[model samples]
Target: MRAVTVRPGAKDSVEVGEVPDPVPADGDLLVDALAVGVCGTDKEIARGEYGTAPPGGERLVLGHESLGRVRQAPPGSGFSAGDLVAGVVRRPDPEPCGACARGEFDMCRNGRYTERGIKELDGYGSEAWRVEAEYAVKLEPHLDRVGVLMEPTTVVAKAWEQVERVGARSWFEPQRVLVTGAGPIGLLATLLGIQRGLEVHVLDRVTEGPKPGLVRDLGATYHAKDIEQVISAVCPDIVIEATGANEPVLASLTGTAPYGVVCLTGVSPSGRRATVDAGAVNREIVLQNDAVVGSVNANLRHYRQAADALAEADPAWLERVITRRVPLERAAEAFREQPDDVKVVIEF
Candidate 1:
């Protein structure tokens, strides 16, 4: 099988080549790769930012957002041939921390979790892949073409789940939501927010692009100016920060309405100086009785929620999210970021 291979921690080594077929264990299900979504993490891995190969392996496959079809499944595995599926990326470490033991590997503590494509495991950027029966999720037949999006959808699903939980800390009836950075995560966050019947506003730098229209089509307001320009006018009740930029993150804390909840979903780079008044921001949170939390990754429950979110979304709108699709032969190009790119996928 031909697979996208990369030498862990080595820059500019991503390439497609033949590899041995996956070895399935007794209870494993073999999935035939159909599509895989490319994102910033794949680019980071290619740039030698951080990636790990499995034990005794030199190259790691380079995709985590995968959609596939079942080629082989153990009888009564709850999946069959031709079923669309996605492989669960993260696995609990051998220690099996309390969270992982409860099937929430996304919340695995002990810093020893292994994730496909990004850390210590081969990924699904290939023609052939396999995962444990319990770790793979089946998709509705209608989602075969768009299911590559399920992984990113799961990210926002988990974030929304956290938002609802955090909002319950006080008297909560959120009506407005502000999402920073209208990228994939931000837009998906916006989608989930609209699904909840909230007044949604998205902030991004581009004045014209697919993003503004995408937001508008979903009946959400889009802003190209800095968040500081309108934070006071709208007084958002829930702020989901997906920019990973320091300024917006700081603003989100102080800009929310009293008792508002803010969820930081972006992983910002370290060492950037944030110009803000720490004491004032603290005072705002304390005085307003607000809650701020961070969310990442997704467990099985979030995956199911993501599927439902996608199902509820207009199919045409979901198709628009996947702005481009490149075949397996042109996989490398899909990893490059483009100005208009909302989501790029590699079709096998």
Candidate 2:
């Protein structure tokens, strides 16, 4: 079987080649890969800026945003042979932290958590893969084509969950939300915002693209202007900052309504220095009781939440989010950036 493999820290080393077929362990489900979504993390790993292979191995399977069909399931596992599923990414460290002990490995405190495709595990980028039954979340049958999006959706689901948890600290009833980025994470954040009955506004740099229309079609406003201008005018009660760029992240720090909750989901590159008015940013947050929290990776609960959200979403809209699909043989093409691309997936 062929799988996407990459040598960590070796730039441009990602390639697809024959690998031994997966062998499931006890309580593991053998799945036939259907597709895998390529995102910034995957690109970063491909560029050698991030990622790690299984211990003592040089090549790592390069996928975490996975979608597949179960080919074999253990008896009494509550999963069938044909179920559509997406495997959970993060696994608890062997020396379980308090969080991991409670099934909250996403919040692992010791920084020793292993993640499929990103850490010390072989991911689901192969022709076939095996996952523990408890770590797989079954998807709605109708999501066959768009279920590759489940992982990214889980990200935003966790972000929103973080925002609400932070908001619960006080009298919080947010009416509007500002999502800073029109990429998959941002758009999906917008979708979840709309589902919550909040007015959603998305800001992205591209003035001409499907992004603007995608936002508007979801009954949200789209802005391509300056981040400050959009944030000031919107005065959103909650800001979901999905752009790791300096400007929008800085603006979100001080540009929300009183008692606002800002959830930062994007990962910015280190060593990119930027000037910031630290005093003012601190003063704004302190005076208004604002909260800023960074969220990434999803746990089992979030995966279930994402599954339900995707099931309720419009199939056509979800299909549009996947702007490009490359076959496994041409998997390298999926890494090349396209000007108007949203979410690119490699079909198995």
Candidate 3:
């Protein structure tokens, strides 16, 4: 079988190579890879910025957003031989801190959680991979073309979960949501917002492209102008900052909506300093009782919720999120994102 291999910290180490077929271990379920989504994390790993191979192994398989079909399942595993599934990426640490002890490895307090393709395990960017039954969640048959998106959606699922959790800190009924950026995460944030019956608005830098149309088609207002302009018009009760870019992050943090919730879902680069009014930001949060939280990775509950979200969404709309797809052989080129690309996937 062929797998995409990379030396974790070595630049230009990404390549297509041959590897042995998966030998299912006891209690392991075999999954035949269909397609894997390529996001910024994968690109960063390729550039030697971040990634870890299995202990003692030099090369790591390079994909985390995976969609696959079950090829073999142990008896009574709750999975069949043909079910479409996506694997949970993170695993609990050995110490199994308080959070991981409760099956919330996504919040491992000791910082020892292992993530497939990003931490210490091989990913599903190959012809096949073996996953524990508990880590694999079955998906609706309708998500065939867009199932690769399940991972990204799970991210926002957790973000929304936290937002609602904080909103419950007081009497809360959010009506308007401002999502910064119209990338995959931001769009999915908008989708979930609409599903929650909120008036959603999205802001992005691109003035023309499928993005404006995509947001508008969902009946959400799209803005490409200054962030403050849109923010003032909406006075959103909830803000989801999906672009880790400095300006948007600062704007969301400093928003003045009383009792509002802000979810920072983007991973911003360090050292990219921005001049922010820290006192004013603190004043807004303190005076208005606003809550700002950051969320990443998904636990089993979030994965299940993301599954339900995708199952209920229109298939046409879900498919539009994946703007490009290429064969496994051309996986390297898939990383070369075009100006208009939304989500890019590599078909195995």
Candidate 4:
């Protein structure tokens, strides 16, 4: 089996190498990899930005957004050997205390973030990876091609869930929504907003990025170099900040309409700390009643919903978000050349 192993150093250290293939246990299923999306977190981990693994694990695999077919299924797995599936990456005890009991696996005290082709469990970027059958969501036959996107889409889905949880209804009607950052998460949120019958608007600082055209093509309004201009004009009821940059997050806070909700999904490469204007936010809340919240990883329900949504959405829309597709062997190239790339999936 072949996998992308991270060599010690910076973001450019990832390399492809032959590794032992993962085998399925009694309750596990063996999946032949199809597509694996390279994420910003991958870049961060490679650059030693987030948590680090122990010594030898430096040779760890590096992908989580994946779609594959069940090459083999355990005797009682319930899935057929040929089923096309997209799986949830996080694995947790079905029973947990406090927050975890409410399905917040990402916040579970015993939850391990460094799992699956990451710092913990082996990941799915190899030619074959195995997992418990319960994690895989079977896709419709017609959706095999676009279903590979289920992994990232689920992320946006989870963010949406948080928006709704944090009183999204008090924000605005489904008619107007603003997405800050024309990146992968923002684009997907725009698509979801559109599907929910909202008029979507996307904002970005770069006047000439590779994503504006695609945003327009996806039926969302694109705003370049002028996020403030678009917000004042549109008065969007919902604003989703996906850039993870302090600028975009602050813009979302100031720009949302009174009583509107803002959801933050971006993982800032510069760590979680940001110097926000607390006084302004305090005053704004008193005057306008706006809400600001942060959203993170998905649970079982979000993963299933995202898989279903991707399976049903138009393939043309999916294609627009997927800027590039590289093989597992070129995983480093995908990360190194990420600035201009939208969503680069590592095809196994």
Candidate 5:
């Protein structure tokens, strides 16, 4: 079997080549790879800025946003051969933390969690892969065309969950939501926000692209103005920050209405210094009773939530989100930026 493999910390080391076929372990499901979504993390790994191979291995399979069809399933696993599934990424550390002990490895406090295609595990970027039955999420059959989006959707699902949990701290009836960035994460965050019956407004730099139309079609407003201007005009009750850029992140910290909950889903690069009015930022949060929480990765519960969310979403709209699909032979091309590309997937 040919798989996408990369040498960790070696720039431009991604290649597709023959690898041994996967063998399922006890309670593991063998899946034939259908597709894998490429995101900033994948690009970072490709660029040698992130990622790690399995212990004592020279290469790591390079995908976490996976989609596949089960080829083999253990009896009583509640999964069958031919089921469309997406594998959960994070695994609890061997020395389980309190969170991981409770099946909340996404909140692992020990920072030793292993993630498929990321930390210390071989990912699902191969022609076929094996995943533990408990970690595989079955998708709706109708999502065959767009289920590659399952992982990213899980990310936003977790973000929304964090936002709601923070909001439950007080009297929270949010009407308006401001999503910063028009990328897949931001857009999907908007979709979830709209599903909650909130008025969604998305802000992105690109003035001419499918993003504006995508937002409009979703019955949400799109803004290409400066972050300050958009945030002031919208006065959103909740802000989902997905840009990972300095400006939008800084503005969102103080840009929401009173008692606002800001859920940050983007991971910004370190060492990018920004000038901030620390006192004022602190004052705003304290005075307004606002909350800012950073969320990343998803657990099993979030994967189920995302599967349901995508199932309920319009298929056409989900299809549009996947702007490009590259075959596995040219998998590296998917990492390159392309204008008008919302989400790029590598098809096996």
Candidate 6:
């Protein structure tokens, strides 16, 4: 089998080459790779920003967002060969650790990567892969090719879960919400906010087209050209920062309404941190009771919900989100086209 690997400790580590095919163990399912989505995290890994590959492994496969078909499944494993599936990247061990006992395995100190073509675990961006049968979930037969993106969409779904950790209200309730930075995460938060009936507003310094159009199409108000001008005109009740830049984070805090909640959804660039008016946040906390929170990679249930939403999204609208489609061989090119890139899927 051919797989993408990051040569450990190499200056520019990424290389696609022939590797041993995955062999299934008892109660494991073997899958044939179909599609995988490259994420910002993958780019970071390639740049040696996220940390080296797991111990005792060379050229760690670099993919987490994936979709594929089952090629083999152990008897009575509850999945059959030929079943199409899309699953979350995290695989939790069933040991009775204190965190696992409380259903907080995502926070489990013992949790480790046990999936295909990932940083620690080999991921699904390959000719074939295998994993514990229980880790794979079957997909609906009618779902289209975009279903491969279930993994990234799961991040939004998981954020929704964390958003629920606080409290969520319909945007239609006349509650104004501001999404900072018009990147993929920001756009996703905007779309989810609009779907939930909020009067959504977005802020970003970049003067661009499709992103603003995409937000408006999804029923949110887009604001860029002048961020402060837009903020002054629209007082938002909730703020989501997804720019991965410090300025947006500070601006999001500045524009939030009294007693509103702010969700930090962006992955900060390496060695970067937001500098905010601490006095302002302090004043807001005392005067308006505002809140700030953060979210990360999703759990198993979020994977299912994200898939459902992606599978149900309007075909035309979803098609627009897909900026480009590149083959496994062009993975490097996909990374180079960052800056204004949206969804880039790597087909196996």
Clash count, one per candidate: 0, 0, 0, 5, 0, 11
lDDT of 5 by residue, 27-116 (tens): 999999999999999999999999999999999998999999999999999999999999999999999999999999999999999999
> How many Å off is the CA of 327 in candidate 1?
1.5
The TM-scores, one per candidate, come to 0.98, 0.99, 0.99, 0.90, 0.99, 0.88
**lDDT (Cα, tens digit) per residue for candidate 1, span 9-96:** 8888889999999989998998999999988889889888889999999999989999999999999899898999998888898989
Query: Per-residue lDDT tens digits of candidate 2, residues 1-348?
Result: 999999999999989998999988999999999999999999999999999899999999989999999999999999999999999999999999999999999999999999999999988999999999999999999999999999999999999999999999877899999999999999999999999999999999998979999999999999999998999999999999998989999999999999999999989988989998899999999999999999999999999999999999999999999999999999999999999999999999
Q: How close is candidate 4 to the true structure, as a TM-score?
A: 0.90
Query: For model 4, which pairs clash?
Result: 114-120, 116-123, 117-122, 117-123, 171-260
lDDT of 3 by residue, 173-233 (tens): 8899999999999999999999999999999999887899889988899999888778888
Q: Given candidate 6, what's the lDDT at residue 168?
A: 50
Clashing pairs in 2: none
The C-alpha lDDT values of all candidates are 0.90, 0.96, 0.91, 0.75, 0.95, 0.70
C-alpha lDDT of candidate 1 relative to the true structure: 0.90
Model 1 clash pairs are none
Between prediction 5 and prediction 6, the one with superior lDDT is: 5
- After superposition, the stretches of candidate 1 with alpha carbons farther than 4 Å from their true spots are none
Model 2 / residue 255 / CA error / Å: 0.5
Which residue pairs collide in model 5, if any?
Answer: none
What's the residue-level lDDT of 145 in candidate 6?
70
- Per-residue lDDT over 174-285 for candidate 4, one digit per residue giving the tens place of the 0 to 100 score: 4688898877788888878877777998988766657888788878888875666778898877889888777767777877777788888887764567777799978876
**What are the C-alpha RMSDs, in order, of all predicted structures?**
1.1, 0.7, 0.8, 2.7, 0.7, 3.0
